[model samples]
Target: MEGVLELPPNVVLRAEDLSVVYKMPRGIARVVDRVTIDFRVGRVTAIVGESGSGKTMMASALMKLVPYPGKIEGRILFRSDLLGGVVDILKLSPKELRIIRWREIAMVFQGAQNSFNPTIKIKDHFLDTARAHGLDEKIALEKACKLLELVKLDPERVLESYPHQLSGGMKQRTLIALSLLLDPKVLILDEPTSALDLISQKVLIDLLKDIHERYHMTMIFITHDLPLIAGLAHYVAVMYAFKVVEFGPIDKIIRNPRHPYTVGLLKAIPPLRGELRFVKPIPGSHPDPVNPPPGCRFWPRCPLATDVCRKVEPKMVEVEKDHFVACHRWEEVEVSKLWT
Candidate 1:
């Protein structure tokens, strides 16, 4: 399995055979399947998939924050500077995990409104987070102010105002600032541009790009938007039905996607500047989580699926240097004109 192989030195975090299962009244729903992927240091990796493809669940699993009733199984090895070595997040105690949450890895959740306390002022949020992490109040305040400014918000005004007083864009930017307060090495953002206007989305995207260039932090951006990652991500991991189907450098994935699902995603995106072409949505709905189809979960929707694909699960295999595809007919997919 890819999880057992020796990882490159640059890998800051790795998830090996990671799976998330929820024992609901209906049945066992595996939101995240046995997946293994490496996150390189100082690179922006985008986890792209449709809604309910387990993007958010996998991100939560990385931070050991899967809510009750959802059990995570597998190794989430993080190269921790605090521990002076690699540590499996799932193995860490609650206290140890708390120490690492913001100081080592922070998450900017999807909804900015829900992330903040309505009654408290913005500065209090910063101070509260710092206090929880045992950071000095004075130093934390200074850093918070600087981060607010970095995100193009006025510290004086933002710090005094409540969450309701800020615009959606302001709140989103503030959330980003708050996530950076502890200077975490890895930042996970779930649907960062959700519920934002076009202008706000563009601004947030630019801010994220600037933040990455300035800090060079390892970032995991979870979004279904394919075009959005084109301008932001260094690497792309395409997930389908709770499993990563294709992963490679952004350029390679964009120019030559080798997975049928990935090609479907690209074709679904409407082009703004190019020859006119019909936009075709990927044909089937997402698989039922509790009882997905047998063998290759995507075979039902995959145009090139053969008898083998319906009988045996395809393992992720290297199609090119640093590029992988988990498709039984990847060679046929590579030469197909679907995406081109």
Candidate 2:
């Protein structure tokens, strides 16, 4: 179990029993299991998981942008000072969702730079996105300049450059600028620093911290990089096999994670200032989403799993004050050695 960081009453977004199912010729595959989470205003919550763990799908479901042939279910509630009331995103019509997309909520997608058209200049991309939301070219240009500066980019040079002319870092910064063009309250960043160099990744991390503090925006950072989130995020959600196995404050999770899956993940991180030691990766692969095993999703790879783990589904339990773990043998598992 980990410790919980209680947020203020001003919650910007919440997902209740959120699930995404894909329709296949054989049968439906549930990619994102029933995940419920509250993203507070002005707080950074990082959702960390390996590939195929449904982290990106969770972000996609938040924006109602899940790929076609995939159907989303459950309540995605969004409350903002701009909206003046709590709105259920799943219930919103396509037109209404569009209204909220950039102005009220924005997403910086994974490989977002690749989404840019090679033929178009970066300035046109920003102008076009802004114009779609009804802003004049003049206003769009001014906002673009300001956002580029906020992201530590030279507005003049970046705006004039094409997607291919800029470096990877510059392209990423441009995407960030575009996402903030409407000053949305909630920004969902899906692997914002994925393919960049280490230096560029650090720069992006610093820029994100600045943006969160400056705009007081609720940022949901989706990535598989657990180490990167340690200092940057206030809260963390550990997902496996499409479900959240453990979640709480960053410090609590780092110091006292109760879930075996979470413990395995922490063990895999190489310590920066420690005696050189071998890092053990989590054993076994994540279950197939379409034909996942019964009972606890992590049971197959969990070392402490028992007979009960193979039969009854383990409900999420509060093992420590505000710390939740969804494993029957959480108390018996000893993972404290990883941190020490």
Candidate 3:
């Protein structure tokens, strides 16, 4: 606990070329491949793509939370080499991982509805978490009260109530509070608002933004909703198959997408009043990651794919300063004229 006070606000997480692979019933499946990214000192980075894009898989690799039957590869550097040493998540012992789980890095899951304990009182869960980490019952209760208050929940009622007693929104609020139990430096949220109503979703988004400002913690948001991510993230990384197809500042990636898969994604999202009408949802489904396409995963559905696109894997190429895209014909392919 004494060491917690000295941790500063900076680049708190570095996931270098991480990968998560599962050898399933059929064959080898690469859920996440070569995912190299970071969360900054006090900003939000959103990983946006359609379902099965492997955004969630990449998030799991960072936390070393990928379950059994799956293997994680690559380095997870906590801080820069000078201040904090690099720790390979795959190599860490459970005891060593306990220190990182919630105290240093926390997670807000997409399906909070399924995460709560039915038999345990909600307050007991938070208190128990604190207790497990060496805090006494009384002190844990007090801290739990503070944590719930931050999320705008009634501490007393929630402490005594069971998971079923609370509404869906309330449960998620509780989960958010729990993820911040030890004032974590990094928070990974996977579609935190997917299960809530519109009003509740807005409330949670506002609460998260407020909390992000207050804690100045690095956050990585994973969601399929493009508009939602656009409003929240400073930078966005777009995924197709198990790899990142595009990664750059939000404006650049959103306004002028280079990857064909990314362009197809933008096409799927509806536009507002007078907005350009270029985007048309790319038809057909994503290629199965278990046995992914040899060349481009999106090639089967990509209308612009040429013969070469079907033959060679496209590496992420620098299209602009700070803008990386993985597409073979991005330079010559001009689809900008389609939207008008």
Candidate 4:
């Protein structure tokens, strides 16, 4: 709580110094290190990092949904109109958390498309979700039909079909519709387009853009795809070794990345309209979660690392308006020189 600050008026949700640790037999794995980030109202904030950089864990921590043996430490404040003010989500009881889950903040989890019950029809999934939240079944079905249409799915057909009867793309779209059944103020999606084809991915992205514009809901997208963020996210938080190395407006972060990791990621993205060039993958593998390097977690892999980077961890500092980077020599990071 030392570094926790008051939430800004525009911020719908904020995580301050959040850490998630799993107690394993050999050693404790600190999957999500002290991460602090804000999700602004009516904007999509993408959390981008390598596969095991704890992107999903951090998102799960926001809803207090970390599985057993995994302990969460820190403050997650949700600006709730229903609760009448900002409430620390970590302090809520199980019952209170359940009430807040779908009605206030819903999450379309990673691989949620395959999580449906095989025996039940799609309409029953909606009814069950509504019943759990104490909503009227008849009204919920009516709303579900409307939401299905909004996602460009045929309501009557999808509602009657079972989970296996739909294609992967259709199931994914249905999951999105289900998340919106309660009209949550905030929506968290973890790798929404992970297993979809390129065409399905495009359709989903366009649908998400339309949903954001129409409902004005705060959305948090968790993925490693920089290309997808370019067209969808308004802001981005670049994570490395479970820490946010850079955060700012999507355009600023893409056009002028300050963190060495961020620059490396941007350089790896192939340009759409240009002479084909070699895509240089970032050097070195991700650090071990249980015992990451001292000082800076990224020091072992950072091209711009110095003696200080290996001995003293850098704090997050504002390089420009609303743009923050955590690097000892952020000012000296030359995009072209690091990879060469």
lDDT by residue for model 2 (1-340), tens? 1243233476778888999999787777999989988887788999999999999999999999999989999988887455456778888778888889989899998995687999989999998897899988998899899999998999999899889998899899889989999989889999998999999999999999888878888899998998987778998999999999998889888888889889999888888896877888887898878988899887788778889999898888888776788989888767765333
Descending-TM-score candidate ranking: 4, 1, 2, 3
Q: Which stretches of candidate 1 lie above 4 Å from their native place?
A: 1-7, 334-336
In order of appearance, the predictions have TM-scores of: 0.97, 0.94, 0.90, 0.97
Model 4, residue pairs in steric clash: none
Query: lDDT: which candidate is best?
Result: 1
lDDT of residue 287 for candidate 2: 84
User: How do the residues 1-340 of candidate 4 rate in per-residue lDDT, one tens digit apiece?
Assistant: 2453457899999999999999888888999999989899999999999999999999999999998879999899988777667788998888778878989899998885667999999999999999999999999999999999998999999999999999888898999999999999899999999998998888888999999999998999999998986898999999999899999999889888899999999888788898887889888899989888999888888888899999999999999998999999999988777775
Candidates, ranked, lDDT: 1, 4, 2, 3
Residue by residue across 1-340, what tens digits does model 1's lDDT show?
2343344689999999999999999999999999899999999999999999999999999999999989999999998878667788898889889888989999999999789999999999999999999999999999988999999999999999999999999999999999999999999999989999999999999999999999999999999998987898999999999999999999999889999999999888889998878888988899989999899999999888899999999999999999999998988885347645
| Candidate 3, superposed: residue stretches over 4 Å from native | 1-10, 80-84, 275-279, 333-335, 338-340
Task: Give the alpha carbon lDDT tens digit for every residue of 128-183 in model 3.
Answer: 78877765778777778988998899998998999998999999999999888777
- Residue pairs with backbone overlap in model 2: 1-258
- Where does the lowest 10-residue lDDT sum fall in candidate 4? 1-10
